[model samples]
Target: VQISKKKFVADELTEDGYSGAEVRVTPTRMEIIMLATRTRAALGEKGRRIPEWTPVAQKRFGFPEGSLCAIALRYKLLRGLAVQRPCYGVLQFIMESGAKGCQVVRAKSMKFVDGLMIHVGDLVNYYVDTAVPHVLLPQGVLGIKVKTMLPWDPTGRTGPKKPLPDHLSIVKPKDEILPTTPILGQKGGKPEPPTMPHPVPTA
Candidate 1:
């Protein structure tokens, strides 16, 4: 993952909307997952860039030739997730893409959240590819936090044992209700308002 980031950033491809990357390494092979907003620019014409990138990845990581596999995918934006209503499809997508486990949480409330609600733990801090992107809403701007379990390997070089954490700190922003002050004459209120003195007492 570090090698991939360096390569993309050096080539100035990050300006082309390169979000980030992930790596799955095993005794036999290494998998490079590249995510970008502009896939066409990042991949070049007909994905010729992948071949160009593969050699460097293998050399930098000291992996054998042909043992390095590169894949490019479009990074999902917060706006896109919001349009999905609940984002269960997102969880399913990641799980299908070799992820050991995955979870998506929108800070805003929804009738049907295919994943979790408010969570509390240090689970998200370990072995998770956590992303909290913001989106605009009628109420206010909110964040959609995604925690994907890193791909695991038997070589023990992979991330923590529990990649898919069970808890998150994301929660919906509560509306603020200002405390109203009661009328001075009313009970449980402030002291009565001061009265003006009689006509300045002979002017």
Candidate 2:
């Protein structure tokens, strides 16, 4: 089960309207996952000293997790479908594997999610200057995800979304985009910035 398709960012139909969830354009460190191909990031300014990517749960639906694999060189989960969303802030994704090899993988959402965000599109501001973590690996510990959009939205509705730039898409991989920089250097080493639009998880 090798990664068949991947999308760093692309245009998508949000509840508010049409906007681009540019994962690369917006500056937010993220930890991406392969199971459902989800992207998540921190909320506070002083995020975390050591980011964690732990598997929460797993169940054999039909496919084999042993076959699911991440690209050794890439930093994002592979995707085979464009504009993919399972449910509830995107519970799963489609693998469009072919260019690299393979065809497709599982259907439902991932079994495990370590500190994955539930739906944080509004707070994903480029001007805010955030570091989103993304998981580059599949099974084992992967690289920090540099993403903008969060995966879980308890309400399943992205709060207030902004008009995406003419060239941002949540379905395409464009590492060319850069994250916004902090307001100032640690000259005085003051307190960290405030966390905007904090997402409250619903049990």
Q: Please list the residue runs of candidate 1 whose C-alpha ends up more than 4 Å from where it truly belongs after superposition.
A: 1-82, 111-124, 137-139, 161-203
Residue-by-residue lDDT tens digits, candidate 1, 81-124: 34453355555555555655655555555322233322456754
lDDT of each: 0.52, 0.26
Best by TM-score: 1
Instruction: For model 1, state the Cα shift of residue 89 in Å.
Output: 3.9
lDDT for model 2, please. 0.26
Off by over 4 Å in 2: 1-142, 146-156, 165-203
* Model 1 accuracy (lDDT, Cα): 0.52
The RMSD of every model to the true structure, in order and in angstroms, is 21.6, 27.9
Candidate 1: RMSD over Cα atoms? Answer: 21.6
**lDDT tens digits, residue span 75-102, model 2:** 2232212212211111222112111111
